[model samples]
Target chain A: MTEEGKQAVAKARAILENYKGKKLRIMEVCGTHTHAIFKAGLRQLMPENVELISGPGCPVCVTPADFIDEAVWLATEKNAVITTFGDLVRVPGSEMSLAGARSEGADIVPVYTPIDAVEYAKTHPDREVVFLSVGFETTTPSACLAVQRAEKAGLKNFSILTANKTMDEAYRALKDSVDAYIYPGHVCAIVGTRLTEELTGEGISGVVAGFTPSELVTAAATLVELCSKSDEPFFRNCYPRVVTRDGSTAAKKLVEKYMEPADAVWRGLGIIPKSGMVLRDEYAAFDARKKFSVPSFKAKNPPGCRCGEILQGKCKPTDCPLFGKTCTPEHPVGACMVSQEGTCAAYYQYGGVV
Target chain B: MCVGLPAKVVSIKDGMALVDASGAKREVSAELLDELDPGDYVMVHAGIAIAKITDDDASEAASVMGEL
Candidate 1:
């Protein structure tokens, strides 16, 4: 570390350690930030008055049960191959998870990227390929690109089941819950500071934070300093190199041209209007919902799981009776335990920071 | 799936950039970024290069911390 970096850490530590203001509830909206904080043992440097809460930033954790059921339906009923990021395979749907469906003769392929799924569809013309697209702004552009790639290649076997969501409305829904937010850095890198600036006008204050230890400490300390100095809401971009004022214009244009905002279901927060993104009418042929005519099944959370409350900052992971007892990561009973970014999984893995 | 990996672009051809993240190399879509070069660093998400990034995140944070 540079001398200036050392001084910055010292200053940030002093600010957090000497905090004497009213109990401030600052929520880290990104699951990666929650894990990074625990990995860095950052909670040990803070005063008791400063509390860090986890919000619904993990895409896998916030994905509703019905969406998984829809994927399972495509895999079983339509006999289509379900291509997804590895985490979703274990997440329990209405009847069974994709893993469970796989055991019963359903083909489920886990790939690192949506383009790989498009490639699979290209090679296997006889099998229909449906990629389970679930993420915030950071991963949506890649899915859009995959759709365009499939179209360009004249691959008619490719389709996507989108659970893509926007973070702006979610921030608004969670605005009154905390004093301020620790915004996800990558999301801001794509969407820009304009969203945060708009939130500031509406009295929602926060700092866009990167995943590094130094960046996290600086952002947290900056939040404490700014919040302590004023009663008015403020916005700060700690991750400036990646997140600019306009963000990635090409990425934004790709999503806007291909997808539209629609009402979507969240596990904990329920349905927030226009929070979800679906393929535009022109691209509906690549949509899994239209291609397979997948029917919706009623979704239910496992009994005694407090993932809903934990996601909204109403409770901590330890508050759930099954957090570590029955809901170990090996035998996860809820989506929160199934995802590495999930609050319950982070708390369980790091033995609870607070 | 939301984590962004910082990698150096080893090569670029036909809207695809071959990136190296600590000796592990893969091809990521460069369609979203313009004016990207072979040596520029980028933030890769899933299979796409979202933004051109600084070579060092810590030093960048240090400079911003000076203002804080």
Candidate 2:
């Protein structure tokens, strides 16, 4: 670390240690942030009055169980191969996870990127390929690009099952739950700081944060210092190196060309109006939900699993009766336990820290 | 799956860039970014280069704190 970096860390810690404000509840709105916070031991550095909470930032964690049921149905009944990021394979559906279905002869393939799924479909012309498109803005463009590539290649067997969500609405829904937020850096890298800056107009305060120790601490310091000055809201792009004020216009235009906002259900937060993205009508042929006619199952979190409450910042992972015992990562009962970025997974990985 | 990998672009062809994150190398879609060169550093997520990383986080953090 440079001298300036060391000074920044020392100064941030000093400010935090000298904090004399009221009890503050700050939520990190990305699952990756939750993991990074735990990995960096940021919580240990906080004063007793400040608390760090997890928000609905993990895309797979927020994805409703019904979406997984649709994927399982495509794999089992429709005889379509399910291609997805590995996290979604373990997330339980209404009946079973993709992994569970795979055990019972469902063909499930985990790909690192949506483009890889396109390649898989290109190679297997006889088989129907459905990529489980579950992410926020960060991964949504890749899904769009995949659909465009499939269209250009004339690959009739390729489609995507979208559970893609946007962060703007989720932040609005949870505005009253915390004093400020540690925004997901990558999401801002796509959508830019305009939305977050506009959020301050509505009295929502936050800082766009990166995934490094110095970046995380600096964001916390900024929040503490700003919030202490007054009750007014503020926004800062702490991770300016990656997130620009405009973000990526090309990516934004691509998403606009392929997908549109739709009312989507979150596992915990329910359906926030226009919180999710779906392929436009013209691209229905590339949409697995329409192409396969897979029915949406009425779904709910498993009994006694407090993942919903945990996701909303109403409670912590340890507050759930099944968190460490029944909902172990090896055999997760809820989506929160399955994804590495999930809050429950991070808490468990960090020895159930509060 | 939402994790972003900061990688150095080694080569580009037909809207695809071969990136090296740490020691691992792979071809990721570069169609999103308008201008990218072989030596540019970018944040790659889900096999797509999302944004160009300007500097290391240490320096970024220093500048952020300097403003704070």
The most accurate candidate by DockQ is 2
Question: Per-residue alpha-carbon lDDT of model 1 for A179-280, expressed as tens digits?
Answer: 999999999888889989888889999999888888889889999999999999999988887888888899999899899999988887788999999999
* Candidate 2 C-alpha lDDT tens digits along A84-154: 99878788777788889999999999999999999999999999999999899999999999999999999
Model 1 accuracy (lDDT, Cα): 0.89
Candidate 1's TM-score reads 0.97
Q: Which stretches of candidate 1 lie over 4 Å from their true place?
A: A352-354
**TM-score of each candidate structure, all chains considered together:** 0.97, 0.97
Docking category of candidate 2: medium
The pairs that clash in candidate 1 are none
For model 2, which pairs clash? none
